[model samples]
Target: MNVSDIKWEYIFNIELAIENFGYVLSGIGYTLLISAVGFALGLIWGFILSLMRISQLTLLNKFAAIYISFMRGTPTLVLLFLLYFGFPFIGVYFDAVPAAILGFTLSSAAYIAEIIRSALNAINHGQWEAGMSLGLPRQKVLWRIIVPQALRIAVPPLSNVILDLVKSSSLAAMITVPDIFQNAKIVGGRENDYMTMYIMVALIYWGICSGYEVLQRKLEKQFGSY
Candidate 1:
Protein backbone atom coordinates (compact mmCIF):
# COMPACT_ATOMS: atom_id res chain seq x y z
CA MET A 1 0.00 0.00 0.00
CA ASN A 2 3.02 2.28 0.20
CA VAL A 3 3.23 4.90 -2.56
CA SER A 4 6.54 3.48 -3.87
CA ASP A 5 5.18 -0.09 -3.78
CA ILE A 6 2.15 0.88 -5.87
CA LYS A 7 4.09 0.53 -9.17
CA TRP A 8 2.68 3.70 -10.62
CA GLU A 9 4.47 2.93 -13.90
CA TYR A 10 2.10 0.04 -14.47
CA ILE A 11 -0.84 2.37 -14.61
CA PHE A 12 0.58 4.39 -17.51
CA ASN A 13 2.55 1.71 -19.30
CA ILE A 14 1.00 2.28 -22.66
CA GLU A 15 3.52 -0.04 -24.29
CA LEU A 16 2.42 -2.91 -22.09
CA ALA A 17 -1.17 -2.22 -23.01
CA ILE A 18 -0.21 -2.08 -26.67
CA GLU A 19 1.64 -5.36 -26.42
CA ASN A 20 -1.46 -7.05 -25.08
CA PHE A 21 -3.78 -5.10 -27.35
CA GLY A 22 -4.52 -8.08 -29.56
CA TYR A 23 -5.42 -10.24 -26.62
CA VAL A 24 -7.94 -7.70 -25.35
CA LEU A 25 -9.16 -6.77 -28.80
CA SER A 26 -9.80 -10.39 -29.61
CA GLY A 27 -12.63 -10.43 -27.10
CA ILE A 28 -14.42 -7.47 -28.69
CA GLY A 29 -16.06 -9.66 -31.28
CA TYR A 30 -17.64 -11.89 -28.68
CA THR A 31 -18.72 -8.87 -26.67
CA LEU A 32 -20.34 -7.20 -29.66
CA LEU A 33 -21.88 -10.43 -30.90
CA ILE A 34 -23.46 -11.19 -27.56
CA SER A 35 -24.72 -7.64 -27.09
CA ALA A 36 -26.26 -7.52 -30.55
CA VAL A 37 -27.98 -10.88 -30.19
CA GLY A 38 -29.11 -10.19 -26.68
CA PHE A 39 -30.49 -6.76 -27.53
CA ALA A 40 -32.26 -8.04 -30.63
CA LEU A 41 -33.84 -10.89 -28.71
CA GLY A 42 -34.78 -8.57 -25.91
CA LEU A 43 -36.38 -6.13 -28.34
CA ILE A 44 -38.58 -8.80 -29.88
CA TRP A 45 -39.66 -10.31 -26.58
CA GLY A 46 -40.03 -6.92 -24.95
CA PHE A 47 -42.38 -5.72 -27.69
CA ILE A 48 -44.61 -8.70 -27.03
CA LEU A 49 -44.48 -8.02 -23.32
CA SER A 50 -45.42 -4.42 -23.87
CA LEU A 51 -48.36 -5.44 -25.99
CA MET A 52 -49.46 -7.82 -23.33
CA ARG A 53 -49.17 -5.14 -20.71
CA ILE A 54 -51.42 -2.86 -22.72
CA SER A 55 -53.85 -5.53 -23.79
CA GLN A 56 -57.56 -5.52 -23.04
CA LEU A 57 -57.32 -9.02 -21.66
CA THR A 58 -56.92 -8.86 -17.89
CA LEU A 59 -54.92 -12.07 -17.73
CA LEU A 60 -52.40 -10.94 -20.28
CA ASN A 61 -52.06 -7.59 -18.61
CA LYS A 62 -51.53 -9.18 -15.22
CA PHE A 63 -48.95 -11.58 -16.51
CA ALA A 64 -46.95 -8.85 -18.22
CA ALA A 65 -47.09 -6.69 -15.11
CA ILE A 66 -45.78 -9.41 -12.86
CA TYR A 67 -42.99 -10.31 -15.27
CA ILE A 68 -41.82 -6.77 -15.69
CA SER A 69 -41.92 -6.22 -11.96
CA PHE A 70 -39.91 -9.30 -11.14
CA MET A 71 -37.27 -8.78 -13.79
CA ARG A 72 -36.84 -5.15 -12.96
CA GLY A 73 -36.50 -5.94 -9.28
CA THR A 74 -33.81 -8.53 -9.84
CA PRO A 75 -30.14 -7.70 -10.35
CA THR A 76 -28.43 -8.67 -13.61
CA LEU A 77 -25.58 -10.49 -11.84
CA VAL A 78 -28.00 -12.69 -9.93
CA LEU A 79 -29.81 -13.46 -13.15
CA LEU A 80 -26.50 -14.43 -14.76
CA PHE A 81 -25.60 -16.69 -11.85
CA LEU A 82 -29.03 -18.29 -11.94
CA LEU A 83 -28.79 -19.05 -15.60
CA TYR A 84 -25.20 -20.30 -15.50
CA PHE A 85 -25.38 -22.31 -12.30
CA GLY A 86 -28.96 -22.91 -11.19
CA PHE A 87 -30.26 -24.52 -14.38
CA PRO A 88 -28.54 -27.81 -13.62
CA PHE A 89 -31.20 -28.63 -11.05
CA ILE A 90 -33.75 -28.73 -13.87
CA GLY A 91 -31.43 -30.82 -16.05
CA VAL A 92 -30.80 -27.90 -18.32
CA TYR A 93 -27.29 -26.88 -19.14
CA PHE A 94 -25.98 -23.87 -21.05
CA ASP A 95 -22.47 -23.08 -22.08
CA ALA A 96 -20.92 -19.79 -20.97
CA VAL A 97 -21.75 -17.82 -24.10
CA PRO A 98 -25.34 -19.03 -24.35
CA ALA A 99 -25.98 -18.48 -20.67
CA ALA A 100 -24.60 -14.97 -20.83
CA ILE A 101 -26.66 -14.06 -23.88
CA LEU A 102 -29.83 -15.56 -22.43
CA GLY A 103 -29.31 -13.89 -19.10
CA PHE A 104 -28.74 -10.47 -20.71
CA THR A 105 -31.70 -10.89 -23.04
CA LEU A 106 -34.12 -11.86 -20.31
CA SER A 107 -33.07 -9.02 -18.03
CA SER A 108 -32.99 -6.46 -20.82
CA ALA A 109 -36.43 -7.40 -22.06
CA ALA A 110 -38.07 -6.22 -18.86
CA TYR A 111 -36.60 -2.74 -19.15
CA ILE A 112 -37.18 -2.47 -22.87
CA ALA A 113 -40.80 -3.51 -22.37
CA GLU A 114 -41.37 -0.73 -19.90
CA ILE A 115 -39.69 1.77 -22.23
CA ILE A 116 -41.85 0.78 -25.17
CA ARG A 117 -44.96 0.78 -23.03
CA SER A 118 -44.29 4.27 -21.75
CA ALA A 119 -43.60 5.57 -25.24
CA LEU A 120 -46.76 3.93 -26.55
CA ASN A 121 -48.79 5.38 -23.74
CA ALA A 122 -47.44 8.85 -24.41
CA ILE A 123 -48.85 8.90 -27.95
CA ASN A 124 -52.06 10.86 -28.06
CA HIS A 125 -55.20 8.74 -28.26
CA GLY A 126 -56.23 10.79 -31.26
CA GLN A 127 -53.70 8.99 -33.41
CA TRP A 128 -55.33 5.65 -32.67
CA GLU A 129 -58.74 7.12 -33.34
CA ALA A 130 -57.58 8.65 -36.57
CA GLY A 131 -56.21 5.34 -37.77
CA MET A 132 -59.45 3.60 -36.87
CA SER A 133 -61.46 6.24 -38.74
CA LEU A 134 -59.35 5.51 -41.79
CA GLY A 135 -60.81 2.01 -41.90
CA LEU A 136 -57.67 0.42 -40.52
CA PRO A 137 -57.88 -2.69 -38.42
CA ARG A 138 -56.76 -2.30 -34.83
CA GLN A 139 -53.68 -4.38 -35.42
CA LYS A 140 -52.88 -2.50 -38.60
CA VAL A 141 -53.25 0.81 -36.83
CA LEU A 142 -51.02 -0.40 -34.01
CA TRP A 143 -48.34 -1.72 -36.29
CA ARG A 144 -48.44 0.93 -39.00
CA ILE A 145 -49.08 4.04 -36.98
CA ILE A 146 -48.62 3.61 -33.28
CA VAL A 147 -45.50 1.46 -33.21
CA PRO A 148 -43.53 3.63 -35.61
CA GLN A 149 -44.08 6.71 -33.53
CA ALA A 150 -43.53 4.93 -30.25
CA LEU A 151 -40.23 3.58 -31.48
CA ARG A 152 -38.98 7.04 -32.30
CA ILE A 153 -39.70 8.10 -28.77
CA ALA A 154 -38.23 4.94 -27.34
CA VAL A 155 -34.89 5.08 -29.13
CA PRO A 156 -32.98 7.25 -26.69
CA PRO A 157 -33.90 5.22 -23.68
CA LEU A 158 -33.35 2.01 -25.58
CA SER A 159 -29.90 3.22 -26.48
CA ASN A 160 -29.17 3.69 -22.81
CA VAL A 161 -30.29 0.15 -22.06
CA ILE A 162 -28.12 -1.22 -24.82
CA LEU A 163 -25.13 0.70 -23.59
CA ASP A 164 -25.68 -0.67 -20.11
CA LEU A 165 -25.89 -4.17 -21.48
CA VAL A 166 -22.60 -3.69 -23.31
CA LYS A 167 -20.88 -2.67 -20.10
CA SER A 168 -22.53 -5.34 -18.04
CA SER A 169 -21.42 -7.94 -20.54
CA SER A 170 -18.09 -7.66 -18.80
CA LEU A 171 -19.58 -9.75 -16.05
CA ALA A 172 -19.38 -12.71 -18.40
CA ALA A 173 -15.84 -13.03 -17.11
CA MET A 174 -17.24 -14.38 -13.86
CA ILE A 175 -18.69 -17.36 -15.74
CA THR A 176 -15.42 -18.03 -17.56
CA VAL A 177 -16.55 -16.51 -20.81
CA PRO A 178 -13.54 -15.24 -22.77
CA ASP A 179 -14.85 -11.70 -22.98
CA ILE A 180 -12.82 -8.49 -22.81
CA PHE A 181 -12.59 -8.47 -19.05
CA GLN A 182 -11.63 -12.12 -18.95
CA ASN A 183 -8.86 -11.54 -21.48
CA ALA A 184 -7.61 -8.60 -19.49
CA LYS A 185 -7.54 -10.72 -16.35
CA ILE A 186 -5.60 -13.47 -18.07
CA VAL A 187 -3.04 -11.04 -19.45
CA GLY A 188 -2.74 -9.29 -16.11
CA GLY A 189 -2.16 -12.56 -14.30
CA ARG A 190 0.49 -13.62 -16.77
CA GLU A 191 2.35 -10.31 -16.68
CA ASN A 192 1.69 -9.59 -13.00
CA ASP A 193 0.48 -6.17 -14.13
CA TYR A 194 -3.14 -6.09 -13.08
CA MET A 195 -3.43 -2.33 -12.84
CA THR A 196 -2.32 -1.50 -16.39
CA MET A 197 -4.24 -4.26 -18.05
CA TYR A 198 -7.47 -3.40 -16.27
CA ILE A 199 -7.03 0.26 -17.11
CA MET A 200 -6.80 -0.68 -20.74
CA VAL A 201 -9.96 -2.70 -20.39
CA ALA A 202 -11.73 0.22 -18.76
CA LEU A 203 -10.68 2.51 -21.61
CA ILE A 204 -11.97 0.08 -24.18
CA TYR A 205 -15.33 -0.06 -22.40
CA TRP A 206 -15.40 3.71 -22.06
CA GLY A 207 -14.72 4.12 -25.76
CA ILE A 208 -17.54 1.77 -26.66
CA CYS A 209 -20.01 3.44 -24.33
CA SER A 210 -19.03 6.86 -25.62
CA GLY A 211 -19.57 5.70 -29.17
CA TYR A 212 -23.07 4.61 -28.23
CA GLU A 213 -23.75 7.96 -26.64
CA VAL A 214 -22.75 9.72 -29.82
CA LEU A 215 -25.02 7.50 -31.87
CA GLN A 216 -27.84 8.09 -29.44
CA ARG A 217 -27.49 11.82 -29.81
CA LYS A 218 -27.57 11.61 -33.58
CA LEU A 219 -30.63 9.39 -33.41
CA GLU A 220 -32.33 11.78 -31.04
CA LYS A 221 -31.71 14.65 -33.43
CA GLN A 222 -33.02 12.71 -36.39
CA PHE A 223 -36.10 11.54 -34.53
CA GLY A 224 -36.72 15.02 -33.21
CA SER A 225 -36.71 16.42 -36.71
CA TYR A 226 -39.67 14.22 -37.64
Candidate 2:
Protein backbone atom coordinates (compact mmCIF):
# COMPACT_ATOMS: atom_id res chain seq x y z
CA MET A 1 0.00 0.00 0.00
CA ASN A 2 1.88 3.03 -1.34
CA VAL A 3 1.07 6.31 -3.09
CA SER A 4 -0.43 4.58 -6.13
CA ASP A 5 -2.51 2.20 -3.98
CA ILE A 6 -4.43 5.07 -2.33
CA LYS A 7 -7.99 5.47 -3.68
CA TRP A 8 -7.96 9.23 -3.51
CA GLU A 9 -5.01 11.45 -4.33
CA TYR A 10 -3.49 13.42 -1.41
CA ILE A 11 -2.45 16.66 -2.92
CA PHE A 12 -0.49 19.54 -1.40
CA ASN A 13 -1.29 22.54 -3.53
CA ILE A 14 1.94 24.42 -4.09
CA GLU A 15 -0.03 27.07 -6.01
CA LEU A 16 -2.01 27.96 -2.93
CA ALA A 17 1.18 28.22 -0.85
CA ILE A 18 2.78 30.45 -3.45
CA GLU A 19 -0.31 32.63 -3.84
CA ASN A 20 -0.77 33.16 -0.12
CA PHE A 21 2.91 33.32 0.65
CA GLY A 22 2.92 37.03 1.40
CA TYR A 23 -0.38 36.81 3.25
CA VAL A 24 1.05 34.30 5.68
CA LEU A 25 4.42 36.03 5.92
CA SER A 26 2.78 39.35 6.66
CA GLY A 27 1.69 38.00 10.01
CA ILE A 28 5.33 37.53 10.94
CA GLY A 29 5.53 41.19 11.96
CA TYR A 30 2.69 40.87 14.46
CA THR A 31 4.11 37.63 15.79
CA LEU A 32 7.53 39.17 16.37
CA LEU A 33 5.99 42.28 17.84
CA ILE A 34 4.02 40.26 20.36
CA SER A 35 6.97 38.06 21.33
CA ALA A 36 9.48 40.89 21.62
CA VAL A 37 7.24 43.22 23.55
CA GLY A 38 5.80 40.52 25.77
CA PHE A 39 9.23 39.07 26.55
CA ALA A 40 10.64 42.50 27.38
CA LEU A 41 7.81 43.34 29.75
CA GLY A 42 7.80 39.85 31.18
CA LEU A 43 11.53 39.99 31.84
CA ILE A 44 11.16 43.17 33.86
CA TRP A 45 8.20 41.80 35.79
CA GLY A 46 10.01 38.52 36.23
CA PHE A 47 13.05 40.23 37.65
CA ILE A 48 10.86 41.92 40.20
CA LEU A 49 9.22 38.61 40.99
CA SER A 50 12.61 36.97 41.34
CA LEU A 51 13.67 39.63 43.80
CA MET A 52 10.45 39.14 45.69
CA ARG A 53 10.90 35.39 45.70
CA ILE A 54 14.30 35.74 47.26
CA SER A 55 13.38 38.60 49.59
CA GLN A 56 13.93 38.16 53.28
CA LEU A 57 10.44 39.56 53.87
CA THR A 58 7.91 36.78 54.28
CA LEU A 59 4.92 38.56 52.72
CA LEU A 60 6.73 39.37 49.52
CA ASN A 61 8.11 35.85 49.28
CA LYS A 62 4.73 34.28 49.87
CA PHE A 63 2.99 36.52 47.38
CA ALA A 64 5.57 35.82 44.71
CA ALA A 65 5.41 32.07 45.46
CA ILE A 66 1.64 31.96 45.13
CA TYR A 67 1.65 34.03 41.95
CA ILE A 68 4.23 31.83 40.29
CA SER A 69 2.44 28.68 41.35
CA PHE A 70 -0.90 29.87 40.04
CA MET A 71 0.46 31.03 36.70
CA ARG A 72 2.42 27.82 36.23
CA GLY A 73 -0.46 25.58 37.19
CA THR A 74 -2.93 27.04 34.70
CA PRO A 75 -2.84 26.74 30.93
CA THR A 76 -1.74 29.73 28.90
CA LEU A 77 -4.81 29.48 26.68
CA VAL A 78 -7.11 29.79 29.69
CA LEU A 79 -5.29 32.93 30.72
CA LEU A 80 -5.77 34.32 27.24
CA PHE A 81 -9.44 33.43 27.31
CA LEU A 82 -9.86 35.12 30.68
CA LEU A 83 -8.17 38.24 29.45
CA TYR A 84 -9.93 38.46 26.08
CA PHE A 85 -13.34 37.03 26.94
CA GLY A 86 -13.91 36.62 30.66
CA PHE A 87 -12.65 40.09 31.60
CA PRO A 88 -15.60 41.70 29.86
CA PHE A 89 -17.90 40.40 32.56
CA ILE A 90 -15.96 42.36 35.18
CA GLY A 91 -16.05 45.56 33.11
CA VAL A 92 -12.58 45.05 31.69
CA TYR A 93 -12.03 44.75 28.00
CA PHE A 94 -8.92 44.51 25.84
CA ASP A 95 -8.49 44.35 22.12
CA ALA A 96 -7.04 41.26 20.49
CA VAL A 97 -3.41 42.39 20.31
CA PRO A 98 -3.29 43.89 23.78
CA ALA A 99 -4.95 40.84 25.26
CA ALA A 100 -2.53 38.53 23.53
CA ILE A 101 0.45 40.60 24.66
CA LEU A 102 -0.70 40.71 28.27
CA GLY A 103 -1.49 37.02 28.29
CA PHE A 104 1.98 36.05 27.08
CA THR A 105 3.64 38.52 29.41
CA LEU A 106 1.81 37.13 32.39
CA SER A 107 2.43 33.50 31.47
CA SER A 108 6.08 33.87 30.48
CA ALA A 109 6.92 35.85 33.60
CA ALA A 110 6.08 32.91 35.83
CA TYR A 111 8.61 30.64 34.15
CA ILE A 112 11.11 33.45 33.90
CA ALA A 113 10.75 34.24 37.58
CA GLU A 114 11.79 30.75 38.46
CA ILE A 115 14.68 30.86 36.02
CA ILE A 116 15.87 34.13 37.49
CA ARG A 117 15.46 32.87 41.05
CA SER A 118 17.49 29.77 40.30
CA ALA A 119 20.20 31.79 38.60
CA LEU A 120 20.41 34.30 41.42
CA ASN A 121 20.48 31.53 44.00
CA ALA A 122 23.26 29.77 42.09
CA ILE A 123 25.66 32.66 42.82
CA ASN A 124 28.15 31.96 45.59
CA HIS A 125 27.46 33.51 48.99
CA GLY A 126 31.19 34.22 49.21
CA GLN A 127 30.83 36.53 46.25
CA TRP A 128 28.40 38.59 48.26
CA GLU A 129 30.77 38.60 51.24
CA ALA A 130 33.72 39.52 49.04
CA GLY A 131 31.86 42.52 47.62
CA MET A 132 30.90 43.71 51.10
CA SER A 133 34.44 43.20 52.38
CA LEU A 134 35.62 45.49 49.63
CA GLY A 135 33.53 48.29 51.21
CA LEU A 136 30.68 48.03 48.73
CA PRO A 137 27.16 48.84 49.95
CA ARG A 138 24.63 46.00 49.84
CA GLN A 139 22.82 47.54 46.86
CA LYS A 140 26.08 48.06 45.01
CA VAL A 141 27.24 44.55 45.86
CA LEU A 142 24.04 43.02 44.54
CA TRP A 143 23.97 45.07 41.35
CA ARG A 144 27.65 44.90 40.53
CA ILE A 145 28.74 41.49 41.80
CA ILE A 146 25.74 39.25 42.37
CA VAL A 147 23.49 40.22 39.46
CA PRO A 148 26.17 40.19 36.82
CA GLN A 149 27.26 36.69 37.72
CA ALA A 150 23.71 35.46 37.92
CA LEU A 151 22.83 37.02 34.56
CA ARG A 152 25.78 35.23 33.05
CA ILE A 153 24.51 31.97 34.42
CA ALA A 154 21.03 32.86 33.29
CA VAL A 155 21.69 33.66 29.63
CA PRO A 156 21.01 30.17 28.32
CA PRO A 157 17.77 29.51 30.16
CA LEU A 158 16.54 33.03 29.50
CA SER A 159 17.25 32.42 25.84
CA ASN A 160 15.13 29.28 26.03
CA VAL A 161 12.28 31.39 27.43
CA ILE A 162 12.52 33.76 24.50
CA LEU A 163 12.33 30.87 22.05
CA ASP A 164 9.37 29.46 23.90
CA LEU A 165 7.60 32.80 23.76
CA VAL A 166 8.17 33.02 20.01
CA LYS A 167 6.62 29.62 19.39
CA SER A 168 3.88 30.19 21.91
CA SER A 169 2.99 33.46 20.25
CA SER A 170 1.19 31.24 17.74
CA LEU A 171 -1.48 30.83 20.38
CA ALA A 172 -2.53 34.37 19.58
CA ALA A 173 -4.34 32.79 16.65
CA MET A 174 -6.95 31.30 18.95
CA ILE A 175 -8.24 34.75 19.91
CA THR A 176 -8.38 36.09 16.32
CA VAL A 177 -5.21 38.14 16.77
CA PRO A 178 -4.18 37.63 13.11
CA ASP A 179 -0.63 36.67 13.88
CA ILE A 180 1.26 34.24 11.61
CA PHE A 181 -0.71 31.21 12.58
CA GLN A 182 -4.00 33.06 12.41
CA ASN A 183 -3.35 34.37 8.93
CA ALA A 184 -2.24 30.95 7.86
CA LYS A 185 -5.43 29.53 9.28
CA ILE A 186 -7.44 32.08 7.34
CA VAL A 187 -5.70 31.24 4.08
CA GLY A 188 -6.08 27.54 4.79
CA GLY A 189 -9.82 27.88 5.24
CA ARG A 190 -10.40 30.17 2.28
CA GLU A 191 -8.34 28.09 -0.10
CA ASN A 192 -9.36 24.69 1.27
CA ASP A 193 -5.64 23.94 1.44
CA TYR A 194 -5.16 23.54 5.14
CA MET A 195 -2.23 21.19 4.77
CA THR A 196 -0.10 23.57 2.76
CA MET A 197 -0.99 26.54 4.91
CA TYR A 198 -0.22 24.71 8.14
CA ILE A 199 3.05 23.29 6.84
CA MET A 200 4.13 26.75 5.70
CA VAL A 201 3.31 28.22 9.08
CA ALA A 202 5.25 25.48 10.83
CA LEU A 203 8.29 26.15 8.64
CA ILE A 204 8.11 29.84 9.34
CA TYR A 205 7.96 29.21 13.07
CA TRP A 206 10.88 26.80 12.78
CA GLY A 207 12.91 29.37 10.89
CA ILE A 208 12.25 32.07 13.48
CA CYS A 209 13.11 29.82 16.42
CA SER A 210 16.22 28.47 14.71
CA GLY A 211 17.61 31.99 14.50
CA TYR A 212 16.95 32.50 18.22
CA GLU A 213 18.80 29.29 19.06
CA VAL A 214 21.79 30.51 17.05
CA LEU A 215 21.75 33.79 18.93
CA GLN A 216 21.57 31.82 22.16
CA ARG A 217 24.83 30.08 21.31
CA LYS A 218 26.53 33.40 20.65
CA LEU A 219 25.17 34.78 23.93
CA GLU A 220 26.47 31.76 25.78
CA LYS A 221 29.94 32.37 24.33
CA GLN A 222 29.92 36.06 25.25
CA PHE A 223 28.64 35.45 28.78
CA GLY A 224 30.92 32.47 29.29
CA SER A 225 33.98 34.59 28.62
CA TYR A 226 33.66 36.51 31.90
TM-scores of the candidates in the order shown: 0.93, 0.96
Residue by residue across 43-117, what tens digits does model 1's lDDT show?
999999999999999999999999999999999889888988998889999999999999999999999999999
Worst 10 residues of 2 by lDDT: 6-15
Which parts of model 2 are misplaced by more than 4 Å? 6-11
> Could you tell me how far off, in angstroms, the CA of residue 64 lies in candidate 2 after the best superposition?
0.3
| Model 2 residue 205 CA deviation in Å | 0.3
Model 2, 142-213: lDDT tens digits are 898999889888888899889989999998889888888999988878877788888888889999999989
Best by TM-score: 2
Q: Point to the candidate with the largest lDDT.
A: 1
How much is 16 displaced in model 1, in angstroms? 1.5
lDDT of every predicted structure (CA atoms): 0.92, 0.91
Off by over 4 Å in 1: 1-7
